[model samples]
Target: PLQVKRGIIDKQTGKIAGEEEYYVDRDECNRADTTLAGLLKLPPVFDTTSGQGSVTAGNSSQLSDGASATLLMSRERAEALGVRPKLVFRGYAVAGCEPDEMGIGPVFAVPKLLQRHGLRVEDIDLWELNEAFASQVVYCRDRLGLDPEKLNVNGGSISIGHPFGMTGSRLVGTLANEMLRRKARLGVVTMCIGGGQGMAGLFEACL
Candidate 1:
């Protein structure tokens, strides 16, 4: 559900404090051949007649040029340095699936992680499922019965662009920030790998 505010209201008075304005601009990358154009122009490469392709540039992750990094430290070291942690790493899990249906990797990985940690889907506050492709994202979200509001509120890789190796880190950063904004307690970051594997991590937001 998209939240729309037409005017600003006073927190104390509970009245319209001022007029508000908003704009909806066209995405700069909206084009027929661009990956950010989404699944419209792309074919199901894996299900193509030629057997060479259905995965189109529009429907797949864009080849982006960028970098990201995440630093980890022991609680003692972090506290000693007066560095306030944003999230605590709980645990992680990996699972495998058929190479042809590699997108289903998260379907297996997430359950293994929850079972290992003795948690359930409703226990999580946020979910960062990497949008490697529209097909995969749609499949995983439906299969997991994820809440639309709790999933990728700021848009996914398809809209922001995926920087391959850095995507995992990006997901973590985004999830952490969103968790903080929502005052959420727990979040999950997960992604599917190329070789029929999926990786997932559990996080507890600080405050």
Candidate 2:
């Protein structure tokens, strides 16, 4: 489903440019190495100096502000509301990282949640990654070996506007709808937050 959208920075002018659609192909993503070394435009995870093993890099500023919300009702509640419920939250997890390295939050959170449910990362059929910054999502993808094609089918807030106070629900609804569209059974939503929090939620489409 469409999860996040983003734009490019024109280095010469130091301004954001027109946004574009980014997609992850599930098949291609799972086959890559642990570092996801094959992706064409992946964001850099660490900086290396002369003969240095590894070093941290600064955060990217290509992020926009946005919010989303979704309403979920129990089976009984749905009946009372006179609406059919098509999905349910299965589980959720959150992780922390250095504030400046906030992009890696999802990488830690998703694996733990998936393990808690006894589900392998491969078991998930779809994914929605909140595009806080292009680098944030890319960092998770490389670290987690997530399939880019299966990552975001619709698009993201980068292309759409990030309307604060509504992104969570928006992402949930979009993922649920995408699951129904593909007739898939499982989906996951993940996002990186400011100040070092990474959040992820798992869901299944109800019959």
List per-prediction Cα lDDT, in the order shown.
0.82, 0.73
Off by over 4 Å in 2: 1-69
- List candidate 1 segments past 4 Å from native: 1-56
Q: How do the predictions measure up, each by TM-score?
A: 0.76, 0.66
lDDT of 2 by residue, 34-115 (tens): 3434333344554434543222222222234445566766778888889977788888999998998776788888998999
Candidate 1, residue 102: lDDT: 82
Model 2 worst lDDT run, 10 consecutive residues: 53-62
Whole-model lDDT for model 1 versus the true structure?
Answer: 0.82
lDDT by residue for model 1 (6-56), tens: 668899999998886545344333455544445555566566787566466
Relative to the true structure, candidate 1 reaches a TM of 0.76
